[model samples]
Target: MFLKGKTALVTGSTSGIGLAYAKALAAEGANIVINGFGDADDIEAERKALETLNGAKAIYSDADLTKPEKIEEMMKQAADEFGGVDILINNAGTQHVDPVEEFPVEKWDLIIALNLSAAFHTTRLAVPYMKEKGWGRIIATASAHSKAASPFKTAYVTAKHGIAGFTKTIALELAQHGITANAISPGYVWTPLVENQIPDTMKARNMSREDVIEKVLLEGQPTKEFVTPEQVAAIALFLCRDEAAQVTGANWSVDGGWTAE
Candidate 1:
């Protein structure tokens, strides 16, 4: 058990990649703190599901990442339950797609708040505890868009790029304290947030779903497949292990060769 006796706080983990990460960590013997912004029913359901996995003590903290106060509160709750966070996965993010000329300011602001600024708030709160313990892992869920630009996603790209930069800088600053920060840049993972956009793109381009996947989404990928959430979670689980202690300030890509070209 690589993470035995450790505690991990994974944000936006009620479903999709975040949920997968929480489960992976728990399976490694880490007590899990799952955070999500959703109704009580759905949150509780995820909480129960995680608890049943290998006797892991899974708890839910419903915090709106857009709010700094709420982020602090969530950190406090996790610390109270698990003594301190050994791992912090900044995985909560929202996306918006629109042409630059017509993009809504509100949407841009919201994406930046949740994707980029929220990490800042959460990391700030988590670091002191980590420094005191002299050991921690901070993983930010960046995207391939962080390194490469795409059409109609200015705010999303900007936030992801900011995450990469933020993680790198913090990794340097926190190295002496036995804390490491890294970013995972995934290509295309089929999550509800992404699946919802498929129809919108199809309508806008007047193409079938197959056409969208073949000609637009997976067109540049050498593997011609969407990266799975479980695959990404596996990499995340590895990074949280003690053997990966020397690996910091890195932006790892699990993009199915999407960015290799």
Candidate 2:
């Protein structure tokens, strides 16, 4: 496998898109560090599964991404175990829906922390190791919201937009170092993150669950299909390949034409 012998660290990987990322990397034989919160037994099962997939090691880190100290500890653990993160996927995120003025102050802070700031913290800690090795891949899971706006998702949109910008800036800074940085902007992935947001959106827009899925969620995309986590993870794997070496600073849209409108 092209990624054999490399090490990858995927954040928010206990389930959903994050888990998909870890699995894709493991299939290519990359030692993996999966981070997030979930049931203890289920997580251990996935960790063991990853090792089986790669015939390499896989670790789980329950680092609270919002806390800088915990992030540092997680990075340290990766360094100690696998030298450092050769590929870093900052895919952890949360969402809340409400009018801008009526949005919860704490929710806004939490969304920003988990979605945007955590990526920043992880990138900073991982970059030095990448630079020293003269090779690295940094991919962030931005959203179609990063390019377009939807009602009642101010904080999520803002954080994703910030991720887009962050990817561009880092790409330039690391361009000469054989390290590529990019953002994968998917339209509406049918994950827990998106599924859980429907209720808040239903409440915000006074719509039923069916209406939220049909009119509110799928209305923007011509395809009218939810993007799969595997699809998004596939793009991330492509970014780690040598063929994608010149593909830095770009935001790839896997949104089924959601942004085409």
Each model's lDDT comes to 0.89, 0.95
RMSD of each: 1.4, 0.7
Query: TM-score, each model?
Result: 0.96, 0.99
lDDT per residue for candidate 2 within 1-261, as digits (tens), equals: 789999999999999999999999999999999999989999999999999985979999999999999999999999999999999999999999999999999999999999999999999999999999999999999999889989888999999999999999999999999999999999888989989999998899999999999998899989999999899999999999999999999999999899987
Clashes of 1: 0
**lDDT (C-alpha) at residue 229 in model 2:** 89
Backbone Cα, N, C clashes tallied per candidate: 0, 0
lDDT of 1 by residue, 1-261 (tens): 677788899998988899999989988888999988667898888788877777768888888888888888999999899898989999999887777888899999999999999999989888998999899999999999889998878999999999999999999999899999999999889898778777766865788998988887888778989999999999898898778999999999999898889
Maximum-lDDT candidate: 2
RMSD of 1: 1.4
Error of 1 at 197 (Å): 1.7
Candidate 1 local Cα displacement, residue 184, angstroms: 0.7
Residue 84, candidate 1: Cα error in Å is 1.9
Report the Cα lDDT for residue 98, model 2: 96
